[model samples]
Target: MRRLALVLLLVASGCRNGGAPSTEVAQPPQTVRNPVPTAYPSEKGDYAVTELVHGLEHPWGLAFLPGGGVLITERPGRLRRIDPDGTVSPPISGLPDIFVDGQAGLLDVALSPDFGRDHWVYLAFAEPTFRGNKAGTAVARGKLEGNALKHVEVVYQQEPKLSHGTHVGARLVFDDEGHLFVTQGDNRVAAAAAQELDKLTGKLVRIWPDGKIPKDNPYVGKSGARGEIWSYGHRNMQGAAIHPRTRALWTSEHGPQGGDEINIPRAGGNYGWPVVTHGIDYSGKPVQGSIGRSTAGMIDPAYVWEKSPAVSGMAFYTGGLFPQWQGDLFLGALAGKSLIRLELEGNQVVHEERLLTAREERIRDVRQGPDGALYVLVDAPDGKLLRISPVGR
Candidate 1:
């Protein structure tokens, strides 16, 4: 039924009557996933914008190190490791050759669930296009060696890659059973590809450790589609995380001009993107009115920012550094140039507070470190690797 809604959206959007392919019109570039430029390291803000690490160019994704440190990935294909002492390690080798044009580049990174046992890590990155300018998103597994990736393996790659480079809202997370969840941006070109079961674009895909589509996935047993499909109707979802306790999945996605969203993902649910939006194109063209009349069967966002903040990374608070903030949802704002903390009283967004808005820095990612402290990555040439904790009274 959700797939049908994607079809209806394509039809309604003056795209086409059926899920047909257009030879001439390449899919929109992954505009939804592209990291927009901003004035990071804001000079003044409500919160103190401390600089953790500098010399980064266009940092976009982050993961905390085992100790008091962080691992940050720059869109230009460099991975820097920053220790709690503020020492920055050189770029880790063995990263895939990212298209690195616009939104395409080395994206999300995460340690293996049993990192203590194996020290393995996984990454979501875009590759040079197989056809046209379409660089496909792929997942790879490796170990962090001295200053490089070891035992690297490209577990999965999107097939029939298109010729566009945009909207690869790629994020990596693992379920309780150890299966990996990957959110692929719609390739920004193939909007209908979101509906086409044969293609992986604009889709939420599930795979085993080795990148094989899961046999028991919801879409398994269905015919004519990749069984890895966990859900559909997403434009470009960049943020993904599994609840440390509930085992539920949550995601953050980018909308066109205004309709950015945060969604709690359910298997087989459709998240309306171009079809149903809280926003329109940058041209002010009306793509959707409100969350009310999007394609039938599409799920509305749990919350939306009327003017897109271009949210990228998200982390739920589970640290002891701020006992008052435990269980809160924190998201990095790129276009909004700040860090947003959403207070929840059991799934109800009861409080909203904007941190570092005075700094006006483009926050690309927020994360909880191993020692239960908060870490944030700024996107800029002089981007800072920041640490947030409670100020002792």
Candidate 2:
């Protein structure tokens, strides 16, 4: 009876239309046999976690500096520097006006690959309109000096800013070739925009560090398409990283209720969102305009969570501190309140381990420090910067 009711609800919500016929089928959902375990043991060794600092207001992003200091961004529109000895600097000044409402605000921070020579810092944030109501994701770059950003300039801005604040996907990643990849969400009220070629929403865009569209971009010379779009048909892609070995871009997207995804976003790839998805609506009904779980032309996710973990930041573990963990993938979970580690063989995830479940804190961002230690940012009114190391040595 329960299954029948769900089928009826799907039909009523119009879940079976507007998709190309396909022979491919979506992967079966994996159930969490044990939702939360007391301890997470790995093949390499046991883990120890240290709280380096606390008292942050919903810290969202983290970047390690050349001189051993860490830069952290708060979602409420502040940036601060934390020294190696755990001293937190006051909020850095000279950031542009940021839209801070609901899920919108200062999102991610990154240092330019040439930071040693250029000192350029890149930031992804929610940019507001002159009216200060509608907002969209934007990227800016500036030189860092003392406690402030100097000569900040907007590099890229998503078009058609929406009034809603949810689904502001703003993860920033730089590829080995010095191209900047910016992820944008569908703005909660605009899922259909993901499939539109001319719109920037729900897309992954690649640009030069100076915000110029690359000539080799998939849509560079295409008619009626945004030249900056590298790939389309994404949902809310909050987590992104470049594979250390492959140099390919991997992203983690948030689905409506379930169906959180891990994807390798290829140039011009279409990742089905409302057209095909493994998840239903928040109200337990099928997503509107969704056909089945697969479509003929859209690329299926490389990995999916049947139960939404509300994934956020992700990193590739290339550091040598954990020899066994090298080449693995680490992701921070907001809903699951844990750090997820996936063992990968090439691009395939063969094993998954959830860490820090005992603490039950929302993990926002995860990164490998200069010293090869795993660092994480906890999202809270009293957020914390945590360092994860081997139990000994």
Please, what is the whole-model Cα lDDT of each candidate in the order they appear?
A: 0.67, 0.79
- For model 2, give the 10-residue run with minimal summed lDDT: 4-13
Q: Show where candidate 1 strays beyond 4 Å.
A: 1-49, 83-87, 288-292
CA-RMSD of model 1: 11.6
What C-alpha lDDT, on a 0 to 100 scale, does residue 4 get in candidate 2? 5
In candidate 1, where is summed lDDT lowest over 10 consecutive residues? 1-10
C-alpha-based local distance difference test score of model 2: 0.79
Question: Between which residue pairs do clashes occur in model 2?
Answer: none
Please give the clash total of every predicted structure, in order: 16, 0
Q: Write the per-residue lDDT of candidate 2 for residues 1-393, one digit (tens) a residue.
A: 000000000000000121221111122111122122122456566877766656666778888777566667777676766543334455566666777778887789888998999988888888877777778889988888876678989899998787367887989999989999998898879889999998898899999999999999999998999999999888899999998878899999999899999999999999998899999999999988899899899999999999999999999998877988989899999999999999998888999999988899999999998778888989998787777877652
TM-scores, in order shown? Answer: 0.82, 0.88
lDDT of 1 by residue, 149-198 (tens): 77888898876566255887788888898889998887866666776777
